[model samples]
Target: MTETFQISPEQAEMYEAKYVPAIFAQWAPLLLDAAHVTTGQRVLDVACGTGILARSAADRVGPSGAVTGLDLNEGMLTVARRLAPDVEWRHGDAADLPFEPDSYDAVLCQSGLMFFPDPDQTLREMRRVCRPGGTVGVQVYASLGSQPAYGPWVELVARHAGPEATRLLSTYWAHGDLDELGRRFDTAGLVVEDVHTRLGTVRWASADEMVQVEIEGSPLIDRISDAQYTAIRNESRELLGEYRTDTGLQAPIGAHLVIARQR
Candidate 1:
């Protein structure tokens, strides 16, 4: 049976509307700029959940340029289509994209490559569909330790959820091994142009709001029981109390942005 978290359209919609725009959308511009996405360039956004990066690319490309969003999840694609019908949306896997070889000028896979079954296969596929000299840019969360407020947050969840919490953490903290990532890219016929750490701020009015988003909009919620959720929430209030202020709270989240050329 499929998991209810990632496979559900309703959950996807919740994630997109809440967590995506709130937490993930800030990096869209940086990823686009890294790829040097410009007007009149054909771009492909692989595993474009909710089309945040795809729609951002669409805007960067202008009317003359085109952007296509692809993902294996119909639930995600459905939401993508409804949000941005103007951009082409395809239901497909990152391991094997549907487009022809050398099809796109640039390929952008933001915060999606980590979830692929085989990152090597997906990287090769991403390179295969990109024109020579074209860029492939990918984003992934920095290790949990490097991220703000994530360590204790994850630890508390682990205390409750066990091995499954580790799996959930893997999704967020995936691709932390930069050496391994570079090796994978090399195997996929991509030459690494740059690998860097970037910091983005996650804000919330209070710890409660943070808890709400992390629970309601997270894929890990499927594994967390009501009791566990309540416990985590209470702990979050105290653990993240430093971030709580009169106006809002800001936590610095970091990501590894990999820019490579298909050689």
Candidate 2:
């Protein structure tokens, strides 16, 4: 069966409330730093996903600079607009950006490249809109194997929830190969300036919360059955014991941040 990657407004809200703090927000500053975004520079955050990176970019660029966030999902854009009324949030596809050539000083896509049907074309769009001497940065999760906790969680879900659910869960870390990612950027005519990994901690209040976000905060919400959810939660209590702390469940999550320039 074909799997859908989209999330609903409710899911998007939960994502902003739960997943962002636990994960995506941590990478926002790092990605902006890698892109060297600064004051008085126009920035475009493609696939902005509730506008975490866009809002962060806004802070970096200040009032003089402009930031526009674009994404295909209206659900995500809706929540994004509510959070930051000042930023320009547009509904558009990443593969075909509705913007003029050389429209931005910096283009960013954080943790969104993996879901694009045509990441190469999307990168080309990013490069196209970026003016000369500007930067383009994209961040993606490293391979599931490299992730200390999630790899095993994926395995547990696969064994209990079956392959379709596993497939959907794996989409975030689908393109972990640095060489391949670099090649995609090169094909889009962007020079690869740097490609490196950044490590961060993913902490959950409890095993149930960890499993809860895995389902509720993503498209996997409706796909997983009650039994499957229960099984994963029960298994995680013991399976992920080593990574637990007095505070919660903490694990080292690594993601690759790639900074490129228009050729």
Top TM-score: which candidate number?
2
In terms of lDDT, which candidate is strongest? 2
Name the Cα RMSD for model 2.
Answer: 3.1
Q: Write the per-residue lDDT of candidate 2 for residues 174-258, one digit (tens) a residue.
A: 8788888889988999999988798888978988888887777567778778887888889988988888899988877889999
Give me the runs in candidate 1 sitting further than 4 Å from their true place: 1-10, 159-164, 212-231
What digit string (tens of lDDT, one per residue) describes model 1 on residues 127-155? 99999999998998888776777767778
- Those runs of model 2 whose alpha carbons end farther than 4 Å from true positions after fitting are 1-10, 161-166, 215-230
* Cα error, candidate 2, residue 29 (Å): 0.4
C-alpha TM-scores of all predictions: 0.86, 0.88
Screening candidate 2 with a backbone cut-off below 3 angstroms (N, C-alpha, C), the clashing residue pairs are none
| lDDT by candidate, in order shown | 0.84, 0.88
Assess the local accuracy of residue 148 in candidate 2 as a C-alpha lDDT between 0 and 100: 76
